[model samples]
Target: MTPTKTIVQISSILEKLFEEHFEKKVEEMEALAVSGSDRRYYRISGGGSVAIGTYNANVAENNTFFYITELFRKHKVNVPEVYKINKDRRAYLQQDLGKTSLFDLVIKDGFTDKNRKLYHAAMAQLAKAQWIAGREADFKQCFASKQFDEKAIMSDLLYFKYYFADLQNIQYDRSLLISEMELLSKDLGRVQPQTLMYRDFQSRNIMVYEGKIYFIDYQGFMQGPPQYDIASLLWQARAQLPAAWKEDLLNGYISTLNELHVPRMDEIYFRRGYVQFVLVRLLQVLGAYGFRGLLQHKAHFINSIGPALKNLEIFLADHPQTPAYPELRSLLEKMSAPDMQDKYATTRGSEQSKLTIQVSSFSYKNGIPKSAGQHGGGYVFDCRGILNPGRYATYKHLTGNDEMVRQFLERETRMPDFMNHANALVAINVEDYMARGFEHLDIAFGCTGGQHRSVYAANQMAEYLRSRYNLEVTVSHLNEKKWVLPDAAKTEE
Candidate 1:
C-alpha cells in the first residue's frame, strides 16, 4: 500500500488498541499520515490529547525511534518529547508538535523565500542531531534486528527484480545481472559508514510547530552511511528542488554540519553524499514507478518518470565518476528518448531468448565464500547478452576495490575488453581456478528451483566479479522473470 494509506490504516488500528488498552471509548480520532519505509503516524483527540501509532513495529525500529528521539533531544535538536511507548504494541504517546508539517509550509500560501531560510534552519537542526548521534551511535547494536548491513543492502537491490521481473514479467539473464550488482555493493561499502541516519528526513517529516523544526517519523534510524539522510532531503521526490536551490540548500546543510563541529566535514564529503543520495532516489523512483504503474495501476508515478529521470540525469552528468552513473545514464537515456517505449520493447527481445543460471552448493563465512560451485547446466547462448560491455564494465570498475578501476572509468583510461563480452561466465570460482579466462565474461548461476540457491549464487558471483575484475555485469533470477537486455537486432552493427 502507499505509505499514506498505510498510515491511515495504522491509525485506525491504534484507535482500537487505545480503546482496548485504556478501556474507554475513543471520542474522536484523527489520523495524520507520515512517510518512510513503513507507514507510521499520530492519532489525536481520542481519549488523550496525543497518541502515536506505527504499523510495522519490531525491536530494531522501536529502539531506533527511542534512540534517535533521545539523541536529538539531548543534542538540543527540536523534536517532540515522547511521553510513553508501548514497544510491544507499536504505539506511543508524545507531545503534540501541532499540525504544521514543513510540507504544508512549503506548498501552502504565504510560503516565501524566508521560509526557505526556515527550512534550512530545520535542516541545520538535523545536522546537529546527526553530529552528536554519530559519536555515541553503536551501529552494530542500534538496528540489529533490522539487518541494515550488507545483507540488507543486497535485499534492497532485489526490489528491482521483484518489480521488474516478478511483477512486470520481463525476462533476462538473472545470474549475470545479479553478479554485476553484488560487485557494486562492495565498492558501495568502501564509502565510510557513520552516524544514525534518519532514512526519511524530508520536509514532510519535519514539523514547523512552535517556530522550530520538530523531527518525527524517525523510527527507522540506523547506523548507516551518512549520505542517506542528506540524500533523502535534497532528492525528495515530492518536493523537487531546483538545481540552484538544491545547491544552496546543500551549502546550508554543510555550513550547519560544520557549525555543529562534525569532524572532517567538507565539500568533498558533501559531493560524495550527494551522489549517494541521487543514486538512492533513482532506485526509489524506479521501484515506485514500476510498482505503481505496472502493478497497482496507478499512473501518477508513470507521469513522474520523466521528471525523476531528468533529475537523475542532471546528477549523473554532474558526477560522471559515481559508480551508479552508467546504470543511471542507461535508464535515463531509455526513458527520455522520444521512442522510449519502442526502444525498450525492441531491447528486451522475446521471453524465449532469455536464460537463467543457477548456483549449486555455495556458502559464505564472514563475507568470504567457502565453496565455489558449478554453473549447474543452465541454458547458454552465443548471441551477445543484454547490456553493452562498456556500460557493464564501467559499472564493474566503479564498484571494485582497485582504485585504478575507478581511475580508468572516471579519467582518461581506455575502455577494457570485458566491455565487449555479452556471454561471459558468471559464477564463484576458487581462487586462481582456471576453468575459463576472466577477460570477457558475463556468467549466471542457477539451480533446479531457480529461487534460493540460484539467487544466492548470483549475488555471491556478482560481488566476487565486481570486486575482483571490476567488470560491468547484471544479475537476474530466472524464476522471477524481471529484466530484459537490448536485442542485438536493434544494436549498431
Candidate 2:
C-alpha cells in the first residue's frame, strides 16, 4: 500500500470507530510517526480542542486503553482526555498532547537544567501516578485478563532468549537456565506487588508541553513490580543520566512512594530496583533486536544491541553478588566466544508475594488523642473552626426574655479544641483500643442551659472537625432547656 493510502485507510478506520462510539465527526486529521510497533497517531481537530488518536489493535484493545487513561485522569494525573473508544475496532480519540516529545526536545538541544528540573518534576508526577494506582484494589482488578504473574515474566525472558540467543547461534543447557530463572522469579515475586506499571516508561514515550510531562504509549500498564517502572526510568534508552542524578531521582521516587504509603521501601528496595533495571533492559534489548531488527529490518533495534550489551556488562560487573550474576556473566562470557551458542529457559514458576506491609500507630490518653502519629500508617489532620462558624449554629435565638440563655447561646461553643484533644487521645490509645475497641465516641457540649450556648458550640465543633480532620465526626448538643421561647403560648418556630 502507498504511504498516503495507508494513512487514509487507518484514519478512516479510526474515524469510523470513534464516531460509532461518540457520535462525532472528524473535522481534521494529520498523521504523525513517532510510535513503536504497528500503532498509528493522528491529530483529529474537532470538539473544542484537537484530539490525538492512537490506533494499535494488536498490542492492546481500544477500550482497555480508554479505561486506563480515564483512570489516570481521575487520579489527578495529566492523561489526555479520552473522547471516544471502540474496543472491537481497536481505536480511540484522546485530547491532543501537542507536538513535542522529550525525544524531539533533546534532539533540538532543549536539554537545559531548567528542562532537567522539569523532567524530574515530571518524574515526581509519575511517582504520584504510581502511588495512587498502586494502592487501589480496582486497579488490580482491571488486569485480571492479563497473566503478568511469574509465568508471564518468564515468557518475556524466553522471547529475549529466542531472538538474541538464536541469532547469535548460542546453545546452553536449557534446564539449568530454567532452574536459575525459577530462582530469580521467586526472588522477584517477593519484591512487592503494586498496581499500575507503565510497562514502557522512558524518555521517548514522554512528551513535554506547557512545562508538564504527558504520558503516552501506556496501554501496557499492569499490576506488577513497582521497581519495573523505576528501573525503566533510571536505565532509559534516550538519556544516560549521571549516577548521582540517578540516585537523586531514585530518592525522589522513594519520597513519592512513602507519601503513597508503600511499606519498607528503604535501601534494600533501591538495590532490588537496580536488579530489576538489568532484567527489564535485558529483556527489551533481546526482544527488540531479535524481533524488530532481525525479522522486521528495524535498524534502530540492531543499533541498540551494542549499547545494551555494554550496559548489561557494566551492571553485571558492578553487582557481582547479585543472584543472577553467575548465570548472566557465564552467558555473556560464552556469547563472547565465536563458537559458543547458548539456549536458556525464559519462563519460571510464580514465587512468594512481595508487598510492603505498612502499619500505623496512634496514641490515646483518657479516651482522647494528644498528638498525631503514624508508624507507617495513614492519618488525616482536620482543622476545625478555621472558617465560618455561624453556618453550623443549631439553636435559634429568642428575641426577648431568657437573657441568660441568649448570652450563653451567643457565646460560640468551643468543642473543636476538645474534639481535637479527643482525636489525639484516640491516637494514643489506638493499640489499647484495638485490643478492646469501642463502638462509638460521643463528646457532649453543655452550657448553663442546653438551649443556646451548648447547641451552637456543638454545631461549630462538628463543622470544624469535618472540615479539618480526615476522620468521621458528628456534633450533638447536651443541653437545650435554658432558653425561653419568643412566643411562649405558641410553640417557638
How do the residues 1-493 of candidate 2 rate in per-residue lDDT, one tens digit apiece?
2232233355677777656655667676665654244566777765554677766645334545666777778888877777766545456677777878776776576546765675677677777777775455244334334424676676667777777766775567677776776666666655665546777787777888787888877776777666677777766544655567667777777776677676665668666755764565566656766676545433355445555555555555666665454665576656634232111111110111111211111112112222222333323222233222223222234321233222222222343344445444433433233335332334443333344434444444443333222234443322223344445425744
User: Residue 226's C-alpha lDDT in candidate 2?
Assistant: 63
Runs with alpha carbons beyond 4 Å of true place in candidate 2:
1-10, 13-28, 34-36, 46-49, 56-60, 86-89, 137-147, 170-172, 260-266, 323-325, 333-493
lDDT of each: 0.52, 0.54
Q: What are the per-residue Cα lDDT tens digits for candidate 1 across 1-493? A: 2232233345566776666556667776544432224434545555454555444455566666677778778778777777656546366666778878887877684347867877788778767766776577655545543324555555566775566434433445567657756766555655664666776687878888777778877766766666767777777655666677778877888777777767764568657756764675466556666665444433344444445555665666677666453543454444444454332231222222222223222112112222222433232322122222224322221222223222222122222122212113332332123233322333443333332333433554454333333344456444443222234324533
Instruction: Name the lDDT value of residue 13 in candidate 2.
Output: 78
The local lDDT score (0 to 100) that residue 209 gets in candidate 2 is 77
